[model samples]
Target: MPPSPTPTGPRIKSPETLIAESGADLEGHGLKRTMGLFQLVCFGVGAIVGTGIFVGLSDTVAEAGPAVIVSFVLAAITCVFTAFSFAELGGAIPVSGSSYSFAYAALGERVAFLVGWCLLLEYGISVSAVAVGWSQYLNELLDSVFGVQLPTALSAGPADGGVINLPAVVVMAMAAALLVRGIRESARATAFMAVLKIGILLAFCAIAFSAFQEGNLTPFLKEGAGGITSGASLAFFSYIGFDAVTTAGEEVKNPRRNIPLAIMICIGLVTLLYCAVAVAAIGALGADAVGDKPAALSLVVDQVTDSTVGGGIVAFGAVVAIASVVLAVMYGQTRILMSMSRDGLIPRVFERVSPKTSTPVRGTLIVASVFAVPAAFSSLDVVVNLTTIGTLATMVVVNIAVVALRRSRPDLKRSFRVPLYPLSPVLGVGFCMYLIWGTGWTTWVQFAVFLVVGALVYAFYGRRNSRLGAAQAQAA
Candidate 1:
């Protein structure tokens, strides 16, 4: 008989190790814990309310009609399950790499490396997609406000009959500069943008609610389960950045107390905003009209109000919100790469911190370069689909890790245990799988290719260079 498998690793980091590696004391790294719960919520909100709302909402409406409201609620339910798991793991680990670090401490080094690689698709590509979408709204706002527009070749993708998206590239470069400066500076800028974006969205809700017509919702559930599932899949993208709250674990004060609360708060607030916005959009213009094009929110506002101001405001919100998303997601990407590099899962260049700014300057540059090229050339649809697949896959791992850790390390203290234990995680996993299944064959092919490439990198380099492997070797 085969020997029983040894449990992989501690589901929670040993308290001694956590204290040694991440105590309150500054270890001369020049890193400071300046982020409060409010700032972290802003980070989550900034990241969550981006191009997904600006562009993807229309697609969801197109798929499920007014029943898209149900889709948003379903998607939020799915996210809440994983968010609880993330809260538990994030509070237990209190690390900077979010799922990548949580998986490493719990699952083992190989899984951790794979999660980090998957995050390349999640954060890196999502930033590019958000940037591309931001460019469109920026152009629209510019045209509406100034009666000037960018050349088609400079404002759109090749698929959209443009040579490059110059505005997207510019937005990314600006964000990269802020990121390289320092986290506090980035947080301040993000907070400002977050406020602007949220205000605009609230304004939209107020105007849309006043114009709401119940007759437009008559054809609710017009699409069936398949359509609701597809709509749920599309709506999932809007919830992407709530995990940003977890990524700030290292910098958060009293992480065990605050991290979970921030995650829950962010998710609740964002869900409320999304549900309100969706209800208003559908009630005013109906679902069929929303999925017509990229700037669907702006279009709906224009159609409902009979003036350009409503559309212009929504467009302006899109520009600010997408800018914030690019900043936050790219920030998360660089930090994750930094953690992986420090663990020797990837190249050491990404681990290098700038003495002047004390940020992962090299990692920021690398991430900016990757995102810049894509935003400058690729289609938004390609980037969005790829990002959605990667994020859903990672969330599935987090759900499984939560359950696996419970069984493996029953003694570990959890400040924020996932409610319903096994059931919640199971539901999280099932929902994530359902969405992954809905991403279609084309996305599956892309995801498979990515996995193959990741496996090769791990086998060739990550296995040998991993910090856990080095630690074990030393012990031997």
Candidate 2:
């Protein structure tokens, strides 16, 4: 078993030690507790309800037929377990870094480091994937409004025969500019975009339901259990950022109470909306037709009304909503690095928050640049798998942390607790690992490669330089 801090040193920070330092206070570091439950939910919905609905659904629907409804529920069930763990930990910690910080307090430095590294794939590569998705919708918006489209070479990556995805890169830079302004401003922007997005979806479902046909649902299980399971695995990606609700920095008021409430509300709302939208899409357009569409909802709107206005509205919202995804994803990435840096596992440069903006300025810039370059020039199809694996891996760690903390520190007061105790965390781990296994052996190989690289980085710098490690060494 791993030591509380360092295996060989007496200067270890036990669960109790780290817990003593955890709270909602970070004013000395210039982070504020200004966000309320509603704002946190807004951030969660903003982070989650983007590309997955606009882009990922068709692929999922293709696999599950009308049973995509069941698949959405299956994916949400998996996320609910993780959501429970996240809420409990976020309530206890009330700080950013999400799973990474939770792992540190409950599992110690080395496991925490691995969680943060895997999260780079989740947040970093995820932002790139969302950027490319945004580019496609933006082009749709532009074509609708201006009757012009980006050149094929400029619209897609080299995999699609494009020289560069200039729009994708541009959108990421724009999102970074907003995030550098501060979390408050970014949250406000995301809320605004999220509202537009929800409105567009509501409008789509209304029009789509008018065309709803019962026949489309025939053979709902045409693909059977295998297809539904496959679809559920892919659909799981749709719920990626509910954890972002927990990582909303130290700027959340009454975090112990608000964090858990926000987490549940966010997941519940997104889950309901996803199921509603999936049903409407399938009913309005036959399952096969829905799968055929590049922008399924937009096409549904177009099909209902001869005027292109409805489709354009959906397109415009998608373009903006995906921008919010980019912002929120990058925000989570920087904050995780910021936390890791504060622990001396990474460079302190990331730990610096601008007093004026209360933002991790340098860290945000670095994340944006790294993601933007890759999204601009390369096909991210492969890396998207890495993102899925990283998310599942992080969820599994969080589940373990939840259980470990429950047993190790029962004396500590928790504002939220995972229901069914050991069962919740156990199922959380089992379900997520099952999904990860379904991702295939090749993806497992890629995940292993990334972890090996992360291990080397940790061995070289983190183990030697970590404050916790140093403290343990001194005590020894």
- Report every candidate's CA lDDT: 0.83, 0.83
Query: Candidate 2 lDDT, tens digit per residue, 41-115?
Result: 888889998888888888889989999999899889999998999989988877777888889877877888999
267-346 in candidate 1: lDDT tens per residue? 99989999999998888777777767778778777877888887888888898899999999988888788677767788
Off by over 4 Å in 2: 1-28
Backbone clash pairs for candidate 2 read: 11-472, 32-251
Error of 2 at 205 (Å): 0.8
Q: Which pairs, if any, clash in model 1? A: none
lDDT of 2 at 246: 74
Q: Residue 430 error for model 2, in Å?
A: 1.5
